[model samples]
Target: MPTGLLILLYLVAALLPLGLAWAQGLTPRPLVDELASGAGILALTVILAEFLLLGRYRFVARRLGTDIVMRMHQLLARGAAILALVHPFLYTTRRAPAPDWDSHRQFFVTADFSALWPGIIAWLLLPALVLMAIGRSTLGFRYETWRMLHGLGAALIAGFAVLHALRAGRYSADPAMSIVWLALLGIALFALAYVYVLTPLVQLRRPWRVSAVTPVALKTWEVSLRPARNFPFRYHAGQFAWLNIGTNPFGLWENPFSISSAPSAGPELRFLIKELGDFTDTIGQIKPGCRAYLDGPHGHLSVTGHSAPGIALIAGGVGIAPMLATLRELHARNDPRPTALIYGNRTEEQIACRAELESIASEHGTRLTHVLSAPPKDWHGATGMVSPDLLRAHFSDPEHKRWLYVLCGPAPMLEAVEDALIELGIPSRNILSERFSYD
Candidate 1:
């Protein structure tokens, strides 16, 4: 829908200028006019979609509809580059009393380097951005580093494009065009400054404190935090937050961890993290009194409005954090919604919050089932992976497909479960799954 609206707007902008020129008898060559207008529109559309809309660096991007937003920006940026190279040529060729070949060569290749410098910088920025984005993981660039470079690149490209358009004087000759350009640029600039500058600075002022850290598994730990003041923003179950560590208010080193403790379960927030890289390994060493900053309460995998006769939750590994929070939230609400949870781990040791989960389930009239893939000898709980057969054997109405199925687990397990549900003729909307890409 957004793509289609963008294309329609592009066509409108492209044709309006050409229509005015034609009516005023400015150009006799129809083909040249059409080509110039089309290229100009394509360039503007790309500018609007890429740097202006989706690429305005924000903390929410990491948790929001990030994948789709990023893909849109990449596609539009490439398209803009192609249009930037074509528009000037078409416009110059169609001008009245066309200049000599040498005159054309001078303007295209040599004249007014000051006016052209910004465009040159934009061209360089494009490929650099593409390289960084594509090679982000392969090049070992951390999220914060990529984010900083990404912001700088976007700002340069946008600033250059705005200057280039005004200097060329072709698109901004009219009042309407000038106003539109300014409005678009203003919006983009505001969003960029707000997200990259203002928000982080505000967070830096009211820093949180790390109160406790306990090892949950070989590579996983539970972190406890308290705000400098009592937080008014109440969080729902299964929501996550972006934790900014070190002196990095620049958004270069932030990680999203689901709140393992329910808001009702405690005054402080708890995050269950697995040591995947440089950040998590040193997280446990963070002093209890050290100030921290958090931006959170995101994700919508909660138990709100999900009132079926029965509920089923499936978690794998650290994914159990959100499910545990959900159960706690339900317990707090005094929701007598009969709920069953199936938690999976590689071994019994990897299962986080086992006792806590069992206690919560028992206290709240819920059922907790543990599923281990590689349990040691003398293990008694449901062994092997949480497969379709396992679910069928354990639950009375596994195939009924009427109960609410909220799944938080590894992608592979979620994929398998989704496939299993489809195989059992369940509607796609009936199943809700959360796939965390924290790694």
Candidate 2:
């Protein structure tokens, strides 16, 4: 589906309950009371919808890009938390039982402890959940532990929010709206089950084994996987996958890595992993022939169907993973398009797959430019960062502006390159980038 249509569908799903509630024609309450109720209802719906935006759903990720989906997930979670926190305080109505004439309970908020307690609990937990997620990196917990906690906490919050809505909400008493809430809750739970249970079960039958793990560059390893059975995994050139090595498929001990090898290169999948976190730092220690599981072919970094006359690959450090995939695929296909690669690293030692890059440049006719921030005294390549000055040196030609620009790097570098490209009159859509960290 088109990205716009997917977004439209999401908005409809999130706001459907509100529309149904309004259609019920409940007696009008004070403006503040309505606002409070609306806030809570919207928050609940958005939280439920977040399950689909967690970057696990291939349909959503393939259409909207995993980076974009994850960023949206983080931002929307904060927005939902804020709305949920303000839900109770925005009420102007007194916390009392409905009078005889007010059968719909529109004139006053619920005083029943059973109905309000769930909302209170959910309201209190929402902020804590958001804070934990925001401080995940600094909390000093393992990534897997943090992920498990985050999932469980989100599930609890969704359950509590749903219970509160069903028992205490004014319009929730309507049969249609009640069913809507139940359906939404069911969908959220199913999403969790799909990710944790169903996917793992499926992976068990199509397991992969680590074929090789060799150091490629400074603190970076090239990990290769081949199917344990006669299974073939299909993927686009620049996509990524969640790789689990020497672990059960059901565990949370996996990390996302770009498929540095091209699909045309056959069933064996390769990942260029850098030493970053707990899982990645141990890549070199993982022995070959270990059991592994892959869950992906995610991201939207591919240059497959682009119609640009040329391809410009700009990468920094290990960000060259996807670019390598694209370049390899292009070479394998004997693609005749003009290609240029501007790869930047901190030092000569940090440049991954240097020989392969040089070979591609020499044999495949790709214009390769290597940039080093901290080069040795004898280094002869371009010096300094992948700044606008460096970009202008290679990409200043008018024809280059119309070429497809693909970038992957640290957030600062990606942002700087994107800004410089836009400043140089390259259309925003022509520049594609994916961040290494969603946070």
Candidate 3:
């Protein structure tokens, strides 16, 4: 689906409960009371919808881009937390038992402890959950441990919020609104199950084995995976996948990596991994033939349908993984479009696949520019960071602005290059980029 249509559907689904509540035509309360109720309802619905934005669904992630989806997840979680925190405080109506003539409690908030306690608990936990997620890396927990905690915490919050709404909400007293709350809760739980249970079950049937592991550069290794059977893994160039090596398919040890091999190369998948974290630091020790699993083909970095007359690939350090895939795929298809690659690293030793990059440039008529920030004394190529000045020197032509520019790298480099490209008159939509760090 197009991104705009997906957004429209999301808004309609999220606001459906609020619309139903408004249709009930209940007695009017103070403006503050109405605001409180509306806030709570919207927050609950947004929280429920967050499960689908976690980037596990290909229909959403592939179409909108995984980075955008994950970004939406983070922002929506924070927004819901704020709304949930202030929901009860905004109420000015009295919380007391309904009088004899008001047995339905249409004019006052519920005073029942059972119904109120769940709301209190969920309200208190929501902020803590958001804080933990924002500070996950600094809290001394492993990525897998933090991921599991985040998932479980979100599930608990959703359950508590639903219980509070069904028991204490005045509008939820209506049968239709009650059913809406229950349906939303059920959908949230099913999303969790689909990601954690069903996806792993499907992966079990198409397992892969590590076929080779070779050192490609300083602290970098190229790992290859071949299917245990005749399973075919279909993916576009410049996309990524979550890789689980030598572990249970359902385990939480997976990490995302861009596929370094072109899809046209074969069914076997290859990844260029740099040693950075705990799992990555031990990658070189992984033995061939170990079981592996891949959940992927995510991201929107490919240039498949682009109409640009040329392509420009800008990569920094290990970010070249996806760029390699793009270049190889273009070569395999014998594409006639002009191509240029500007790859930068701290030193020459850190450059991975140097020989292959040279071969591709020679064979495919690509203009390859290598930049080293800390070059040896005898080094002769560009010897500074990939700054705007360097970009202007290479891509100053007006025609260059019309060419598609794809970038992947550290956060700072990606930001700098993206800004420079826009300043150079390249349309933002024509400049595709993927950042390794979501934060």
Candidate 4:
């Protein structure tokens, strides 16, 4: 689905309960009490929507991009936590049960433990979940482990929160509101099950086995996977997949990696992985013929359908993975358009597949520029960074602004390069980029 439509759906879902409650036409309450209810319900709805933005749903990720989806998940989660924590204090209604004559709960609010316990549990859980997510990188937990726990924690909070709403909320007293909340909760839980159970079960039939694991550069390796059978996986250039090696289809050790090989190169998939800890640090230990599973062909960064006059690919470090795929595909398809690859690394040793990149340049007429931050004293190529001045020197012509530019690199380089590209009179649509790191 398109991004705007998805957002519209979210707005409708979030406000449905409030609309239904207003339709109930119950007695009026204090403005602060109504505001408290609105905040609580909105927070719950946002939490439910977070499940759909789980960063694995292709319908959302393909349109919004995984980086945007993940960023949205984190940001909205913090917002929801704040709302959940403060809604209770915003209430001005009396802390007492509904009177014998007041069946609509207009003037009274339940302070009973039976109705408040679930809300209390959810209130405490939300902040902890947000904190864990914020500090996850520093917590020394495996990505897979943290992801599994995060899902479980969110599910727990959703269940408790909705239960409390149905039991205690003045607006949720309406049957329509109850149904909406329950249905939304069901959808959220099913999303979790789909990622954990259904997707893995489907992958069981189309499994792969590692064919090779060779060191490509400093602390980086090229791992190859060939289908055990005639697996028919098709992905565009500059896309990625979740790779689980030597683990069951249901295992949590899977991690996303950009496809380094072109799709035209048969059933084998290639990935250029740099050691950054976690599963990557153990890449060397993964031998050939180990069972593997892939859950993707995700990401929206591609140049397949563009009719640009030329293409410029800027890559830093392992961000070259998808660019390699794009270069190989363009070469295989015998594209006539001119192409340039600007690859940057700390040293010459950090450059991966130099021979192949050069061979592409020689055979396919690609212009290859290598930039080194820590160059050797005798370095003949471009020294220093792939800076704005270098970009200006190469793309000095007015026609270069119309060329399609694809950039993948560290966040800082990407931002600097993007700003420079826009400054060079390139339209925003003419430049394509996805940050390897969202934060």
TM of each candidate vs. truth: 0.77, 0.97, 0.96, 0.96
Stretch of 10 with least lDDT, candidate 4: 430-439
Per-residue alpha-carbon lDDT of candidate 1 for residues 313-375, written as tens digits (9 for 90 to 100): 899888888887888788887888688898999888888877777787889878788988888
Name model 2 segments beyond 4 Å from true: 436-439
What ranking emerges by TM-score with the best candidate at the front? 2, 4, 3, 1
- Better by lDDT, candidate 3 or 1: 3
Task: For candidate 2, write residues 244-328 as lDDT tens digits.
Answer: 8998989999888899998899999999999987898788899889999988878999998899999999999889999999999
| Runs of candidate 4 exceeding 4 Å displacement | none
Instruction: Write the residue-wise lDDT of candidate 4 on 1-439 in tens digits.
Output: 7779988987888777777878888877888888898899999999988898878899888888887788888889999999889899998878898888978887888988999999999999999999988888888888988988898899999999999999998889778889999999999999999999999999999999999999989999999999998858999999999999999989899999999999998888999999999889999999998999999989888998899999999999999999999999999999999999999999999999999999999999999999999999999999888899999988879989889999998999999999998888889898888864545
Q: In candidate 3, what are the lDDT values of residues 1-439, reduced to their tens digit?
A: 8989999999998999999999988887888888999999999999999998878899997778887888888899999999998998997777887677875565777888999998888898889999998887788778888889889989999999999999999888789999999998999999999989988898999899999999999999999999998977889999999999999889999999999999999988999999988689999999999999988778888998899999999999999999999999999999999999999999999999999999999999889999999999999999889999999988889999889999999989999999998899889989998764556
lDDT of each: 0.69, 0.90, 0.91, 0.91
Model 3, 366: alpha-carbon shift in Å? 1.8
What lDDT score goes with residue 184 in model 4?
A: 93
**Superposed Cα RMSD, model 3:** 1.5
